[model samples]
Target: MKRLFRILIIGLSTLALAACSQIATDANSLFVSELTEKEDAILSIASDKSFVFDFHIDSEYKEASVWIEKYEAGKLVDDRLAHLTTEVEQSGSIIVTLSENTNENNNSFNIGVGTDENLTSINVSDTDLIGLESMASVWGSTSEKVAIDNGEAVLANISYSDDENGMHSLTTDFFEDAAGHMNELEKYDVAYLLKVEFVK
Candidate 1:
């Protein structure tokens, strides 16, 4: 009787652990699509300019790491950036600063990770600047597609327009998944920083 009770307890414990693992796997799978989008956008943007876009991966079952890719003329020009492992707390923020040689004026953009609480704003010197409007238009179109495909239900609350500074700002709360999950594993909010600065 004692042996039977011990075996039953062990079986129940194993089943419980397996169930928990399945739940985590399902939750993590929902985030895979979002992660793919980030990679596609980053690769596409990198192909156009010689710059680095750093990605911070966060996962409980796997080691977190950063993947960097460089691009120029719509192709990966080089792999100057290195991949680095990260901690769980530092997983959400993916900062991609343009190399100094790429942006001679030191003008750069910083995008937020999982929220629009901290957005990057461009600074345009002239009110009649054509480049600023063009940049805003390009970003608006690209971001709209990403937002819709991601099923960001609150996308209506997001807006992309120019500010009084002649600079363009894309502000929106459409950064989370359909289930209202924060999806911090993927940096969806960093889309704004993917814009390319044209050389004058």
Candidate 2:
């Protein structure tokens, strides 16, 4: 009788785990399907499909000076005229920058169309900025897709978690160079950072 009871418990645990797995799979499918639909529609109707490089870094940017700010510390510094001039090519991983000592916040960045059907990919590469946290979609967009960043916040948190090792990482893998079904025409406004003062 004891052996039979043990078997029953084991069976129940297995069932529970299997159920959880199924649930996760189903949820992911639904999410991906929805995202694909929206992205397809957006791309289908997009007028300006040219490869665009809209990036700016603060002129006052000093290497390793702008540390990741803590979550609770409100805007510590501000800078106007922080956007420095830059030259960008069609589609490749070029380091774009933003700085607190500039006009706009660097952490919160944007990526999207430029000017026909020239651009074929979404700019999904490494970034050398602060951090990210989820809120009402990344940067106010609805299709906040999966991201593989060095060790920053990840929305679509349904898929991944923060890297355990706390190292300064500067990379993001969104729609990597026409690899995914959803290509360009998706404007990305990422807002996933926890600001802190300069760290050691």
Candidate 3:
């Protein structure tokens, strides 16, 4: 009986390991980006306009959150410019809209995530937030330009802190990787999406 129990335990362990491996494989293809100018060195847009993102998500994900990160000259400036959490249906197209507001010396941005309508909208307008000089500079002149590194997205659920800046910022330890990079996503039965882009 002892030997039989040991065999059973070993078999269960192997099955568990296999299941973990399958999940890792699925993660790689869970999110698909459909940006037309993804490879462009710089994506130019009006300071008071919105950029729309159309992507594909696996049917397994029913709920997800999308956020943005600002980068300048190959460095991170803001990790949570905007965040939107919403529910998703089966495998289909997911649209995320990022709207920027830089008027009258005031800088802010909003994110909307949903299929055909704005299911969730998150607005962020804080002066203390980093990576605003670019948007601020473009308020008065068209020749002035500020460039950032690039835009990328990841999937994971993370914690945020609103007490610091009156807006949400990454405050969870598990959301980062060993190198303290925001790309290291932490999963808590939900999905997180991020996009980083530099203006040149």
| Number of the top lDDT candidate | 3
Q: In model 3, where do residues sit more than 4 Å from their true spots?
A: 1-47, 91-104, 116-118, 129-200
lDDT for each residue of candidate 1 in 92-196, tens digit (9 for 90 to 100):
223332211222322222221221122121211111112222222113212322211222122211112233444332333323332343332122212222221
RMSD vs true structure, all candidates = 19.4, 22.1, 19.5
Q: Please give the TM-score that candidate 3 achieves against the real structure.
A: 0.37
Candidate 1: pairs in clash? 46-71, 47-74
Per-residue alpha-carbon lDDT of model 3 for 25-63, expressed as tens digits?
332123322233521211233223233333334455555
How far in Å is the alpha carbon of 28 misplaced in model 1?
Answer: 1.9
Error of 1 at 69 (Å): 1.6
Give the winner by TM-score: 2 or 3: 3
**Model 1 regions more than 4 Å off:** 1-26, 29-60, 80-82, 89-200
Q: Backbone clashes in each candidate structure, one number apiece? A: 2, 14, 7
Best by TM-score: 3
Instruction: Score each candidate by Cα lDDT.
Output: 0.26, 0.22, 0.35
Give all TM-scores, in the order shown: 0.24, 0.16, 0.37
